[model samples]
Target: MTKQPAHIVVAGGGYVGLYTAHRLQRRLRRELGRGTVRITVISPEPYMTYQPFLPEAAAGSISPRHVVVPLRRVLAKCRFVPGAVTAVDTEGHTVSVRTVAGEEAGGEPLRIAYDELVLAPGSISRTLPVPGLAEHGIGFKTVEEAIGLRNHVLEQLDIASSTRDSAVRSAALTFVFVGGGYAGVEALAELEDMGRYACRYYHNIRPEEQKWMLVEATDRILPEVGEEMGRYAQRELRGRNIDIRLGTRLESCEDRTAVLSDGSRHPARTLVWTAGVKPHPVLAACGVPLDDRGRVRCTTTLRVEGVDHVWSAGDAAAVPDLTAPPADPPALCAPNAQHAVRQARRLADNIAAAVRGRPAADYRHRNAGSVASLGLHKGVARIYGRRLKGFPAWLLHRAYHLSRVPTFNRKARVLAEWTLAGLFRREIVSLGSLEHPRAEFELAAGSRRHPEDT
Candidate 1:
């Protein structure tokens, strides 16, 4: 009787999934070629987005196409499946997937059996039950959201420039971003810079006329950069006339008005929510043991605890941080790119070791500090007990992430874009029609009437 090949299925194509499967392709080359091992990577999108460049992409400093790496092009040795893993059956070693095509057709999900499972489904934006939030709030996680936000901001500028009504203009010029973390701060800074720069071309609007507000539930922003640097960032943003509302919560956004807990209300058209993230929901349905925070419980080796033939890591797993000091309760690895990338490599190595009947090694690495780009020619960094701010930190931020971006092709493209951006003026054109490509054509053909026509 012939021995069936072992199938390994990896969920999520973010940092963990991409690097893990990429390394496995190299580590299991012998088994792969001998038809003894097979690897399949599944995710909603076919590309892995390098999220650090999203703000630059949104601000038009880098081309959006250059920020994502195509999985098929990079993982030649492994199969790529473009779908989301809806549920996992740990006992039966099977996962249910809903492909994009099947989802559009409302068809049933497909089930695939695997010998080894990697649960790195990642996380989603954590939201609240605030009224009108679902209708008005925009998320900044994916490249689509980032680019759409760029278009939307420019469109708001257009509305402000042309509107005769004061209320309409005021609302159009006001932009509110909730959350003080890297995503919220960087996005608000870049877009505000872009919007202000764009004001130069409009005869009706001034840079000061644009109201940019950042609301944080906590007293400080950029907590990852430490307290001193966070205060510096706050001062820098305030110097530019940005309203920094600290220790404030959003009470409601009904009818496009932002009502805060401090009894202040602002009628704003754009509200960006980047408060935080929660683990993906598939972990709850998978029947695997999970931590109190809803992440899969995994050993330091990245193997799922109390589950056979299963491994997990990244934002979806609660792997202990061996680097932390011994205490009554040890700290877990943070859900950030620094840990995710390293954890992935370790996970792949342990899987290869298990295949060859070797002992698994625990994943261990100290945090490398944090760097954040505030906007063009501005940033903050904290590394190895040293602090950097202003232009030097900005340059370091670009250099660090540019080197970390996957593929030499993407790196070259991004560096080239940065070079060109420095030499030329920023692009502020709004391609909002890209969101609805067939609107004009449909109107002309009379197949579909415009909303105004109805």
Candidate 2:
């Protein structure tokens, strides 16, 4: 006889959903002895990308595969449905999702019913109205973008080294990164390190000739690392001949001319938009209460106001931080990996209590501090107010994240990759075709078309 599935749907299998599922497994292993509670995760992606290492991936410090955790493998007990949840029908107790082939492609829609729903759709690349930006600029968010940027940059090096045309060469060599935040700084730093090393292989190109600029609208960078570390980073980057512009916004990308709000202009081929991100729009669609910023409003217990069967956390939901009694979660928990992992655990525990009809626990955590790898052994770290700069911080950053990188197999592989990279030079080969989904489609269509006059 067929039995009903005791389903719990978790939307968006990034850090929050994936970890929450893992926690549920741990918490329910004994409960499952009685045969009850099933968990399913729905999202466009079948994996959770450890995004903090994206810069290193782009710089060839680590293999791309090492930075992402396959959701199906990690969440072995949970049903994995790869799709984008477009809407939620609270009355129907169901969610709508677009059953796509993958995150990189668009696909058909599907309706899914659920007993309990947890939305953790995560954020997208937050962009602005800068001219020609969309056509020319790239973001440093996903694995694809990191790989694409790496390939594009390496291809640029090849183009510059091979071409004698000055304008083309200049455009090919120039790389501009917009944003001074962690993503922008780390990516630019790592890529610049790669570029500098690559220049040695080019007979015509001088190390000093290549242009790189980091344009930040703010006066400083790495706000989380505090002022001292931020200043130190600026000095280190400047010593490496990296042009760091403060108080400037990228006004235009039209005509391949980079214009600044400060009235400066330069021609560059590469533009990386890593300004910041916003909460996913799915929070508003769930018909739950929301804050002014569209984040799901939750009390300290991580419960959605007036919604009995729903709970929220991570970048998608605004759960109050009781630790910050006087403040509102240090500005929505800064939307990073650290908070997401913690929030996922708390949410899991809270959800378990809700299911068993028990008092829920409150979410409260202190700031553990921030760490960023500048390039290679160069890094900055602030651990609970103690400031660190250079290699020591780099070690801490590696040790800390390596411990939190999900699976033991991946953790070992990542360590091995790091060890090998230190001994050998970077693999700077470009695999740009990874971005084009229809490279063969044109050939297929062209072959089918009537033979040309040729």
Best by TM-score: 1
* Candidate 1 lDDT by residue in tens digits, 365-403: 967789998898999999877899999999989999998
Supply candidate 2's per-residue lDDT for 121.
85
Output the lDDT of residue 59, model 2: 90
212: Cα error in model 1, Å: 0.6
> 1-454, model 2: which lDDT tens digit per residue?
8766556789898889889988988887665555677888987887899998899899988889988999989988788888788888877888888774433375445777887778888887788999998988999999889989999999999899898899989988888999999999999999999999988888889878889899999999989899989999999999888999999999999888889998988888888899988888767677888888778877777777788667778887877656654752354555788888998999889877766768888888888999988888899999988989999998998999899999899999999999998888778687787778689888898778565755
Please list all clashing residue pairs in model 2, or write none if there are none. 43-83
TM-score of 2: 0.93
Which residues of candidate 2, in runs, are more than 4 Å off? 1-5, 101-109, 325-331, 437-454
User: What's the TM-score of every candidate structure?
Assistant: 0.96, 0.93
Pairs clashing in candidate 1? none
